[model samples]
Target chain A: MDVDIDKIPKHLLRFEYPIFEFNKAIIDATHQYVVAYKPNMAFYEANGLKGWKSLEKTIKYLNKNYPEVFTIADAKRGDIGNTSSMYAKAFLKDLDFDSITVAPYMGKDSVEPFLNFEDKFTILLALTSNEGAFDFQTLSTQDSPLYKKVLETSKTWNYAHRLMYVVGATKAEYFKEIRSIVPNNFLLVPGVGAQGGSLQEVCKYGLNKDIGLLINSSRGIIYASSESDFSEKAAVEAKKLQLEMKQILENHF
Target chain B: MDVDIDKIPKHLLRFEYPIFEFNKAIIDATHQYVVAYKPNMAFYEANGLKGWKSLEKTIKYLNKNYPEVFTIADAKRGDIGNTSSMYAKAFLKDLDFDSITVAPYMGKDSVEPFLNFEDKFTILLALTSNEGAFDFQTLSTQDSPLYKKVLETSKTWNYAHRLMYVVGATKAEYFKEIRSIVPNNFLLVPGVGAQGGSLQEVCKYGLNKDIGLLINSSRGIIYASSESDFSEKAAVEAKKLQLEMKQILENHF
Candidate 1:
């Protein structure tokens, strides 16, 4: 779910909503191999009102045409209690997304409102896949690193079962430790391809009996090409990753 | 700059864009007392595309009519490197806001992109005015709390001068400790009116020779009344706060 006016195929410019058209092409081509479509909100938001409309169309298309596929609004949002409720309602109820990414910087009250929605999931940032991730996330608390405390403390909240952690693919070594804290909960792992994180490394320690991992690849798949066959190229990239995951599952199971 | 369809005057609903119309009335009434208008993104986003349009109108109204006043897109947005850059461009460049609030859970790389803008400010969340703030912010690190570390570490980043912090007015006791670390940088202090924080307490320790403190009162002022004269009532609330602040400044000076 990454589209930029400059980066999208020039041919798409003729459409009323090029971003939505590009997304529809990619979704139509790759829906069979993918279980979830995580649209990074920043990309759509950068375009303003048009960007927002494109996002609304993309989500509606998925919900209507491909109900089986999960939808994640990669809008990293969290705030005070009432404010968080508004965000929860916006993303989960209004947008009708299955889940939305959230930052845990504001703590429990900021996050719990999102958990109130029955089937909706809240993906909390634990250990992000970026160089700056080490800044505060990895800071040593009294006994353990801050990320560990986040994983440990969040488990005690209401509707904890609906909580999923965003454990970056870039930090595969931290998977074993993260799994110990959040063994059963699903993990949304980003940074697989473009960020140089090994898919095998993430699967080795990330997989559980439920196959609890939603490995995400943004730039690697969606931006695979910018030509007329952009969606086909995206599908090929998605298929390759899907095949790798299948192989890894066979070896694990 | 908070406007809600349910909370605004019933008569405003007759307008095409009630939220924007309501905001315009409030700004028209209270602009003299205010130096900045901070619109919480959740309210606008909850209404979808129409909500977004209202937000664009509200900001445009402020930029055009009250150019002397600062505009803040209170969108607590932060993501991985490139994604953060997209957000920075959205709020700071595309929306033409003077500043945007950011959550720092992802750390320096997530925040630096927002700071990259020449004159636009980045208000990083440090100690938010909420009960959940205690969850991670107050955690004891090796020597100082996580928030102090946030204040201490963030100062070392590029364009640190462009950085201000969201230090909740709820915990006025922490202001002295916070001032010691970042003495000169302005602190956008929320939780003043509705959340019950003392303007006197915040000004005592949080003030610098530059008088660097932006005290915020949201619900107490904006929702002052839901009747026909809602904006007039809101002006009264805003005036009261301004008077209190004026007295504090007089005594401090």
Candidate 2:
């Protein structure tokens, strides 16, 4: 769950750590309906040290109370070899998140370091949900689009089994082509709800025999209300999406 | 300087904050020779909250003591629109670094927010130093290599004037081609020294009318010695690169 302090309920602002409190309330309200709780690092890092503290508290709360629930650190970080290794250790080992999103611009060595962690998953950005995804991701290469090349090339790296791909819900049409390359891998689809992507459209082509799709809708559910009953409202929104996914899963099976 | 606790002198480790102390000594010795001091976020992040506190102290020290020198947060970060903006604010505004290195895979909107900040430069990754750079960067695109396309396409971005490119010093042959595309922009050239890149070769083609290059040698200089005189040894190494650059500049202009 991504928490923006500005959008948080006014009453919660009086607490010593509002972000952490808001996150706790949301998790308590919606944990039963969701399998994973992904916190985008940007929102936390933007607030500097306090933001980081909230992140630490939130993750600790999850591991302690909801140990079975998966957690994702949606930090699209990638760098050169040694640098990447440090980041891998920081998030996956130190912070102890189950997965962290990474960018593929630096290629093999930059990403493989993250995969070295035993059970940790590295979600690599294949096709993003933003307008900018059209900028370089879909560029015509000799054999296929650049995103396709990323998927193809990355599959050969060491510890490839630990990797997952981020395919935007907005680009549902591309899911068929993406699944053709890496059908078994779990796809973190993030552009649904607020980003204007249809849940039905993404699930139609994104699902595999393993039900390999993690459809994410950050703002749509988390920021469902700005009043004192924000967490309850968020749970309502989360329940709606959960019911939709439940129906999709039952029908698919 | 990249401060690795394991590589630091045993004596400094006793200090309350070894990373900050090591950075201060290194800056005191080498500040006169270097135009910029870049601390890769990975190094600071690996240590967790204490690491972040050390980074904050280091940056604050630089801004106060050596205000003229440029500081780079070598965090090759990029993401969707709103997310990228948060990173931009955290590093450029909140943390107040002069510049940051960003990955270009996410495209225009992901990068444009960084450029929106006046006087702050956004260094976009083009040709990286790592072996994995060949994975997608050198792919045969419709017109040119992927890195070249990155350089060409990024040049037309919203605040194009604020953009810089990262062309690894290891790939010196590509510098002439890179310079042709970004003649006026500064290129953050890493891979010299320990990474096996030759400064003279990178300068041969990478230099433009503005002498556009920020040659970086992190490990080679920072970890010069593991003994108590580490900072002194670091100064000697920094001096060697500075003298070499001085001679090259005198010969060229």
Candidate 3:
């Protein structure tokens, strides 16, 4: 099992409240524990235009201030070819994140455009945690789960090596089965913390030799405390997770 | 059947584009022939902070200037509950789009979040044109195709009455089958112009009693003329389609 997303980008795009102070406190508190940070696009987007601007500032600040940390645009974007290229230009070129999460529904062409950049990565949706997941991803076709097929077919791509998959942390058990097919690719696991996924279980099945896991706990960490100490609380929560992850990694490696 | 979505906000949440020129040209040219304008979120999003702002401007301009036109934020966004709420707020609340293209792999809670909005609409991915669409969407579950079940189960939601589905124009034959199940609900048809889908055939089986179809031609219209005459050429192309659609509507109605 590998970490979901191996190479994080420079910009951490999300809605960190109280902006500068919030990020500073969080960064100060738990910089050592976290390898990367992801700011969900909707959080900043909900705040309206000014919120979007703040997202930009947040990415720039972290890239300039803390180069050690990897940043991801937690934007699940995918589209047709020419439009996809435009998206590549937008997220990869203009905003300059290390990787962007994408939906794989449009097949390889839609996904490949994003994989063109040498350093950039593409995180494809695999087995998601939500109920609708049962509606399609888990459905069996040709004697295997659809997600298994998604993983298998994705490997056919030359740039599939640059691909990381999004496996909802809540569905950790599937990681063992998912690993049989997609052994080397990174997995970006969310749905931990506030979403109630078991981090221990995820590690049991999802970790690769490379320690390649990016488990995200958004609301649980970011909104840990609404007051001035919010980022500090976020740091505490992150530290706790990281500490546990370190033990898991040590035991396995 | 009905053109959904409310209005775009005044705030600059997305990227800025040459909205007036580009949109006006598309509107003027295709105003009579086309039924909808589907701008994939990635396009606006590619501009980073500026992209979302432009998305807002683009949506607002469409809603205000051309009430007859239908708009879609081809956001292909679907996630767990809390996150889906934020997505709904971002696209439907913050910006006005007639419909949002949602991925149905996540199940009810993920999709229902979008359905809660009145007048606003949700277009679930039933069958897409991509090659890998075969990997999951068409997979046989027991006896039914996954896309078939998606169309069936989505009906369980009361708000689903407001739901439309995405049936790729490329899969035009599926439209005949999809129409049998969802005879009344609208279908948001994409892949017509440049993704190698045909419009005449798509309309043959896809249209319903209300002309329940929103056929989108993005690159075919927007990038019609990359030169200064791009917008003018776009208008000419759009008008050609709209005129054809007008005849279709007249004959069908």
Candidate 4:
């Protein structure tokens, strides 16, 4: 969903609440430059259920406002089969999001339920931005970090074509290594801007031929200005990233 | 909350809204055994915004009807400082949960905001029940898995005395391993019966003299019967676990 910054209500500015203001403003300023909007569900959820209500309203507003924009719920959810089915029902059925971010730690049964949906996508947590990313994600079992094995194993899930991955911008250094493993699939890049991630380095290796990157800039854009001009500043910040992304898309196209 | 399992409202019996019914019934049965009832915030959330409302009601119900039960919003939340403050507002102010579960992955700044609450507890995710647990939890970084460092570091937080740890039921093998590290703190354990975790094993290694284990049996007890008999069965299941716990406490005292 392209969250047009100008369309947001002023009272909704919050870091905890990754509001439609961020999504709308960013989309208003940059949707033409990018293919998807990945609103990390945690950002809105951290605001309590009210923030979630805002998110639902935001997504509905987007569907009505920008039918062309793809909606990705950056939820990072994955669980046992029955649980995943319920999750899929929650986000895909009730919320009507186009995609969801998932954690593939529980293997097939946990992730497959999300994949069962026809067009909705599941972006699995591959390599994160934190220092602890090195803890379990990069730990070597047979010569490859466990993240690689996750990518390799994920390929076997039948309905996995709708799958994508989360490769943090902070780990842009490993994008080249990651792309070599799963070259064709889309990647949702987070940890850009306010998180100290370099957009230039991330595009260099993470971008696939489809201009395949949904780079999420949460705090940097949404919480750009805590004051009344927050939405406008978010547009400015989003435009900056979009301009850089436009050049990256040009090279591939 | 008094998880009103004994006489569940008819609508929620078919695992339709299991957390609601299960929580209610369990509370009715085990409120005496626990000072706190922590339904993993993730479980309710996995159901999306509507599920979030149920959580709100659950917390409200506990505060209204069973005020003695300290409600823990088990979100396993940990983020940057300002973000953490907003989260504090989300749960403490918005949801009004008496406690919360935090992730200690980030360090002091990530956990401190939650600890600032005088009445609220922040139960850190120290040791989990998942198989991937060995991937990081047991890593010999300087001394032990990051969990040990969490337990030690948390000791210095001003209200860290209110802190707890999520030690899994399956990790009872590390009973002696854990006892040596933390002798007094409460452990919120999942992975009982339904998850192939043994109650005997968990108590063997995990029970402190204070009966410091809020061992949650969600699926096993709640889903024990899909019919209207669910609550009755849930009460039966909870009583069985509580009885065993009573014996364990008897031996300890």
Model 3 chain A: worst 10 consecutive residues (lDDT sum): A1-10
Q: Candidate 2, overall lDDT?
A: 0.91
For residues A1-253, write the lDDT of model 2, one tens digit per residue.
Answer: 6677888989998888899999999999999989899999989888877888899999999999999998999999999888889999889998999999999999999998999999999999999999989988999899999999999999998989998999999998999999999999999999898889999999999999989888898898888989888889999999999999999989989
Interface RMSD of candidate number 4 = 5.0
Clash pairs, model 2 backbone: none
Clashes of each: 0, 0, 39, 16
Candidate 2: deviation at residue A66, Å? 0.7
Per-prediction TM-score, please?
0.99, 0.99, 0.88, 0.79
Can you write out model 4's per-residue Cα lDDT over A174-232, one digit (the tens) per residue? 99988998888999887887678998898888877677788877666656665667656
Kindly report which residue stretches of model 3 are placed more than 4 angstroms away from their true locations once superposed: A1-17, B1-17, B28-33, B226-232
DockQ scores of the candidates: 0.92, 0.88, 0.52, 0.23
lDDT for each residue of candidate 3 in A1-253, tens digit (9 for 90 to 100): 0001111111332434344435555666777878877767766676667667767776777788887787787767766666677778766777777888887766777788899988888888888877667766787776787777778888898688888988988898898988778888889998888668998899898888776678877667666665556557777888888888889888898
lDDT of each prediction vs. the true structure? 0.94, 0.91, 0.74, 0.70
Residue A155 in candidate 3, Cα distance off native in Å: 1.7
| Best of the candidates, lDDT | 1
Candidate number with the higher DockQ (2 or 3): 2
- DockQ-wise, the better of 2 and 4 is 2
Q: What's the CA error at residue B124 for candidate 1, in Å?
A: 0.5
- The TM-score of predicted model 3 comes to 0.88
At residue B23, candidate 3 shows an lDDT of 55
Better of 1 and 3 by DockQ: 1
